[model samples]
Target: MAHQSKRTTLGEIGEHAAIRVIREECPSRNNGDDAAVLNQPAPNTRPVVATDMLVEDRHFRFDWSTPEQVGIKAISQNFADIEAMGARPTAALLALSAPKDTDVEVLRGIARGIQQALEPFSAQLIGGDITGGEKMVLAVTALGQLGGNRKELRLDAARPGQKVVANGRIGWSAAGLALLRKFEEIPEDLRPLVEHHCAPRIETNRGVIARATGATAMTDNSDGLIQDLRLIAERSGVGIDLKSHAIFPDELLCRAGKLTGIDPWEFVLSGGEDHTFLATTSKETPTGFRDIGRVNKNTGLVTVDGLPPRHEAGWVSF
Candidate 1:
C-alpha cells in the first residue's frame, strides 16, 4: 500500500535517506562505519565468496516480478553459490542502481526482501552502495565461512564410482516461466510453479550436511542439470551418466508441460535457476539428497540414461 501512495522519488529524499531505509529494515551487527567490521573467522576454516548481478528485462521484469521478489531472487542465487562450495553464509553486500525517479518505497521493499531471504541462515547485510542508472540493477556479493575438518567441495573432485545426487527441486521454475508466457491467467494448481520462478527457497543446510557426509564434489544447479554436470565432467576429467528414472519428475511440471505443449524432460535437463544442490559422493548419499547417477571414466560427455540430451546449453549470458 505504501508503494501505491503518491510517489516519493529517491531524488526528493536524497541518498542518505535511502541508506537510512536499508539500515532500518536490514539491521546488521556493525553500524556507523564506512565498512563492516567482522569478527575473526573460525580457525582451520576458509572463506567462500560469490557475486551475481540481476538486470531488469534480462533477469526479471517489473510487470512479472515485484521489487521484493527481485531482491529475494538476487540473494537466493548468490547465497546458493556459497552453499554449493560447502559453506554457511554469514553476510551480504548489496549494490543497487536505479533511475533517480524510482520510488523510495520500491527500494525499501527490496531491502526488506533481502533481509527476509537471509533470515533462515541468520546472515546480515554488511555494506553496499546505491547509484543512479537507466534501469534497475542489483549486484549482490555473498560471504560464507567453511568450518570444521571437512574438505571444501569442488567441482573437479568428482571421480569414477562416485554417486551423483541432488537436493531440492528442478524444472519447477522453468515450468512457471512457461506458464507465465503461454497463459493469460495462471491456474490455481500451477501457482506453486509461478512462485518458484518468482522466489526459490533453496535448502541452505544441505550444503553443510553434504560436506560433513563426505561429498566428493558439489555445485548449485543455477544452470540446467545437464549443463552443470558437464562442467563437473570436464573439470574432473570424467563422464556422468544420469539415470532418467532416478530423477523425481514433479507432477506439477508434467501438468504444466502438457498444457503448454512442452516436454517436462526438456525443462528438467536444460532449465536453470532452481538453485538445487547437485553433488557426487563415494559414501552414502546425504539424508536429503536423492541418488541420480554416477561418475565414470572421462569420455568428455554427460548423458541421461546413456543418451545425450537433446539440448546441452542452459542459461547463457552474452
Candidate 2:
C-alpha cells in the first residue's frame, strides 16, 4: 500500500512563518531610531526599549495556558519591564518561532492577544518576524518614550532608612498554580484570583509616581519578593529589612486560607510573576504603595524578621 502525505498550510509552519512574513513586509528599524516607522511617527522623548523571551515548557505549559493568554502574557511582561524602568510603552515588536505542525489560528490568536494587551496601554505593534523551530518561543521587545526630563528610577540609588513600597498584588500565581495542580477543579469564586495569577495587572502609574516621589531605587517584582529585594540590595550597596506584616492581601488566595489550604504569606513572600514595582524613597511613598521594608547602610544583604531573606527564593533561569 502507498502512504499518503498529510496536507499543510502556513499554520502548520507555526509562528515562524508569520514572523518572517511580517518582517519581510515591514520597514526595518536597524538604524537605531527610537520610533520605528510602524510603531511611532514622532521621535519619542524617553526612547526606552526592552525585550523578553518566553520559551515553551520553561515559562508556560501549553495545556495550562491558552494561545491568547500566552500572547497577552508575552506582551504584558515586556511592558512591565518598560514600566519598571519608569517609562511609558508606546510600541512593540514580536518575534516568534514554533513547530511546523501547530495550528495557524493559535498564532493568529497570539497576535490578537498582543493587540489586546497593547490596546489598554494605547500602544501599537510596529513589526516583527517569524521563524521555524522545534519549540514554541516568543521574543517580545517593548519601546517606551519618556515624556520630558523624567529620569528613570535606577536600582543603584537605594538609601539607608528609605522605606520600601509595593504597588501591586502578589502570590496569586503560586496560589493559582496550586489550585490547578492539587484541586482538579477551580471554584467559581476563585476564578478571578486565579486569572490574576495568570495575568495580574501591572502598575502603570506607580513607576512615574515613584520617580516623582524621589525614589532612590526601584524595580519590578518579577521574581519573588525576597529575591528581587536582594537584587536592589546588591545593586544599591545596602541592606534591606522587610516588615512582612505590612504586605497587603491583593489576591483572593491572600484571603483564601481555610478553603485554599495554602499559606498566603508564603506566596506573598515568595510567589513571583506578579510584575509589581518595589521601590525605596526617603520622601513619602505614594498612596496605593504599601511600605513593606526599609533600606540600611549595610551592603548586599536582605533580611526578614532580623534574619537574611530565607523565605521563598526568587526565580532562577537555571
lDDT scores in order: 0.88, 0.74
lDDT tens per residue, model 2, 1-318: 398666454555644556544434332454123434643435546578899999998887777677777878888888888877777887888777877766666676677677778778877677766667888998999988665565687888888989998887767776776676666678888776667665566656677677777776788788888788888889889999887567645547655544667667767778788787888988998767988888987788887766764466667898
Candidate 1 lDDT tens digits, 34-74: 88888899898888999999998888877777788887898
Model 2: residues with Cα > 4 Å off, grouped in runs = 1-35, 38-44, 248-251, 254-262
Model 2 lDDT vs. the true structure?
A: 0.74
Task: For model 1, name the residue pairs that clash.
Answer: none
**Candidate 1 wrong stretches, greater than 4 Å:** 1-4
Model 1, C-alpha of 87: deviation from truth (Å): 0.5
Q: Which window of 10 residues has the lowest lDDT sum in candidate 1?
A: 1-10
